[model samples]
Target: MRHLLLSTAALLAAALPVLAQEAATALPETIVTATRVPTALERVPASITIITRQQIEERGHATLAEALSAVPGLRLAPSGGPGQQASVFLRGNSSRSVLVLLDGVPLNDPSEANGAFNFGNDLLFDVERIEVLRGPASSLYGSAAVGGVVNLVTRRAASRPFAPYGELAGGTQGTVRGGLGATGTIGAFDYLASANGLRTDGFNATARRFRNTLNERDGLQAGALALRLGWTPMEGTRVEGTLRYRQNRFDLDSVPRDDPNSTGDDRRLMGQLRAETRLLDGLWTTGFRVAFTQDRRAYVNLPDARSTASTRDHYRGERLGFDWGNTLRLPGLGFATDGALNFGVTHAREEVFSLAGNTPFQTRVNAAQDSTAGHIALQYRLWNRMDVTAGLRHDAVGSFTGATTWRAGVVYHVPELGARLRASGGSGFNAPSLFQRFGTIGTAFRGNPNLRPERSLGYELGGELDLPLFGRPDFATLGATWFQSRVRDLIIFQGTSVANVDRANLQGVELTLAVRPAPWLSAELGWTITDATDARTRRPLPRRPEHVISATARLTPLPGLVIAPQLQFTGRSPEGPFASYRDDGTSFTTERRNKTGTLFNITASYVVREGITAFVEGRNLGNSRWEPVNGFQTPGRSLLVGTRFGF
Candidate 1:
């Protein structure tokens, strides 16, 4: 089997040569992130990828999970379809280490069962674009940003005129999806409203792998509504408010044995409001974001043991932030002084309730925490072709106290050298979640109030080259980055069959690149190598793989059309806990490693005519029989077709 896998990998590698005949174009302009401002992507000194709406539609992506499935160094674990509990991992980091943002609003539910929101069931119809920032972001985004950040930006009223658009798509896996949206300008006000729905009879979650006691078939139905009201009452001032609501019905299956029959449903809602004023050439902005989410589960058991047992988890969190940043042409410094000062506070409350017996296992846990932070950042154009930036931040979390993060970055552009050198270093911190504090599980586990926050010190160095052959325009940009980070007092779920686990330290590196040498073709490759281990034993972390890679190439045979081939690789990883399991089936015991897997996918799309287009996409084109988890084989192969028309 291993030999066959290797041979297939080789064959795929050999095919790339024939696929490289396409042409390339110059890099796209950067949209400012990290700071509440706009900046060129080339000036950020960080690794970021922006997945546009066109790409999402052309790829036949039904949800955010499907859209991100092909992004390098990103792992999306979907229990079923659009409405399932989805886990997102970046560079081998825990799902909790990644921060998600909706319309520049942080969507990480601090009150969530585990201090994170599942991205699997997140609907994506109203999103205009997605920006993925890789590496430590604590200096700007704090908390779960230790891994990276995903910001979903929504569409606004079209500048041209009021337009209405809609789409309908259905395919294998018992799926149906639809969306409707409208945007228009009314006097000095521009507004947009959109609503989308998706449903699917998803594949069986448990694939009879290993103990294979659970045989649960899952399904999902989700809907999202969004509204954006923009008030441009004046030229220098603009006020916008965005409201979004999402609901997901997810079925969760219990682990092997332990009565097996049980399921759960999850729901979430988020909102953001902001006001911006351009006073004296500086942009001043203030905003607040709020999120509420809940999870409910039911257990099925034998008639004799049929004591109605169930669990419900609820979370509520909010953030109030205000910032005043500005840009000034500094003649004395021989550069532009673009700077920003931001201050914000966050409050979160979490509660978990459960019923375990015929009567009720009524158990509830609650806590409220607050955090305050401030930051100042500056960007300078040292030369016509070079730019440098420096920033510092300070955050205070109740009980956890003061933590500071700072970074210095420089970008040197040499049109003649065909080189762009970029580098940045900073510090980051993740406060203990409410669950990690005063929370408690069943008779099996408990929380630790004495746990400390996790901290990390890291840096990244990389460069992009627009190489040229003779007098040609080069038409290609080659970029690569190498990064390393070390964390202290990492938070991890640790249990020795008796007590619950706490968070702990983690360390790792991420390497990524994008290259295009021709006008018709381009390729991107990314790999994440991590050593996320227990701070004490230094043993490898559970569920986190040591190596992961994603590669892809695009071919544009004609204008207004594109075809892309992609591959995703995940190295050997354990199927269950990393420790021994007792008779209760709960422990630190490690399950056998799930064999490495390489999946091939092809995506193609073309414009049919003005205001209309169609697309076709296929997954696992090789039809390889592989197991994402032991014994449980993934779908052999699947295909989806879709179309969209606008007026």
Candidate 2:
């Protein structure tokens, strides 16, 4: 691994000079979080990757998971089928360690049965771009951001008069898909809307061992409708509302014999509304947003249990918030003050019921969380052509006990030294999930209500340098960053022993590089390696892999044509077949198994006419057989051909 690091560094050094001699577009120019004030990507202190709209269209990436997989250090844990359920991992951390946001709105739900949003069900038809920040973000984001953050920014009404577009795609395994989108301005209002549907005969979660391996192979069907309406009545005051609905149904076949014939059907519907006033007076911006979401899932198990053979789970939540922020430029002390003061109240409710014939063990739970947070950031330009930024934030989590969280950080730039330095330390926490509190059957095992909220205190030290002296042709932005974070009290499942089982600690690193030699070609590579062990026993984390690497390249050889090829490699990771088991009555441990796999995906597209295009994509071009989850195998070599037309 050390050698690979050195080799990559050497490669970058060798490629930079060659790229400098060629004509290349500057790195992407817009970002919202690095400065809390939209700034160019080149100025951000952390390692960030942006998947542009062009990449989305040219690569034939139809879903969020597929789009994210080509990125290094990021891995997708797919489940069931299209729009079913999938988890994203960053730098070796699980989905529980990553934070997901849609235009700054957190999608995770402690009220849900699984404790996290089912991302597989999220359709990407409306997404404009995706930004992935690789490393500790607790200083900026808060809890569950221990690994990183994936921010999905949706599209807005274009300035164009009026436009409507749609597509139809069909493929193997009974797969069929279609979508419709429209954007325009009418009078004083601007609006955008899109609806997409996908259906497929998903592969079996487990292979031949089970009786219904094919039975385990189920069907997947889901649809989503999202609309955004904005009214800019005046320059200073504007209002916008967004409504989205996602419906999904797929069979779940990973149930133990103690409870067989188990399957799940799930549905989610969500909406948000916001109003902002710039005040145009100095640098004051005030905004208010009200959001709501509801989720329902039903599961059916063995009819021979007792008498009742089915279970039902219903979960729902809503959030209300108001915020006021100000930016004050003070040249007097070389200080610029920008801060946001936010107040929000949220309500959550959940209920799970199990029935067998005449017997039923039903449970219902509810909770409310009110929070207030404030943060101030300062930027100073020193005499040595150096720029430094310092920031601090304080958050109060609840009204009952008032749990508080805080974060602080600073970034310094030293151009003469050819180095950019940044360091941040922060504390974040996540409340216990509803399923963790009230015993339930979402997992083959039972939940423990005694579970406690997870918390952590961690810090990171990182630096980046540009190697323009190296001689590679397509070396656009050649820089690398490394970061490490320590997390304590990580949430985990426990079936026995003290506190009836709970949480642990986690640690990890990430590396990325971008090379764009000429205007006609480009390539990006990334790698992430992690080590998460039981702080006490030093044993490996259950399913987290140790290594993940990816490479992507694109070529536009013709005026209206684009072709891309990608390679994804995941290093052997250790996992136990069962969470726990006893052998020969000795209770000895079962040796962990390590798996290593690779996959290739390709796409080709051409514009046959203005606003009209045809494309074809092949996934797992290598026809590689890989396992995303234990015993559950993924698809092998699949093809999708489609076309799009617009006015």
**Least lDDT summed over 10 consecutive residues: which range in candidate 1?**
496-505
Candidate 1 matches the true fold with a TM-score of 0.84
Whole-structure CA lDDT of model 2: 0.62
> Residues 1-647, candidate 2, lDDT per residue (tens digit)?
44554455456445544444333334447887555556556445556778877788788888788888866567677754465467776655657767777776666755554456556767677888998876655545554666667888988787776888778888877778889999988877899999988888766554333343344456777788988989988776778888888777766655221223555666666677888777546355666666656555655554544336555545554445444445544433444322333223332232333222222345444555555666566554455334455555555554322334444545565444344555565555555555555544433445555554466665554545443423642244445444444555555655531132434455445566666676788887777766666666777766667788888888889988889988888777666645322321122257464467798988998899999889898888886666665454566677888998777
Error of 2 at 459 (Å): 3.3
Please report the candidate that would top lDDT against the real structure.
Answer: 1
Give the least accurate 10-residue stretch of model 2, judged by summed lDDT: 579-588
Name the regions of candidate 2 deviating beyond 4 angstroms. 1-25, 138-141, 208-212, 255-263, 280-282, 301-372, 379-387, 398-422, 440-452, 463-474, 494-505, 577-591
- Where in model 1 is the C-alpha error above 4 Å? 1-28, 78-81, 210-216, 257-262, 281-332, 335-363, 442-446, 469-475, 493-518, 558-560, 575-588, 623-625, 629-636
Full-model lDDT for every candidate: 0.63, 0.62
- lDDT at 17 for candidate 1? 35
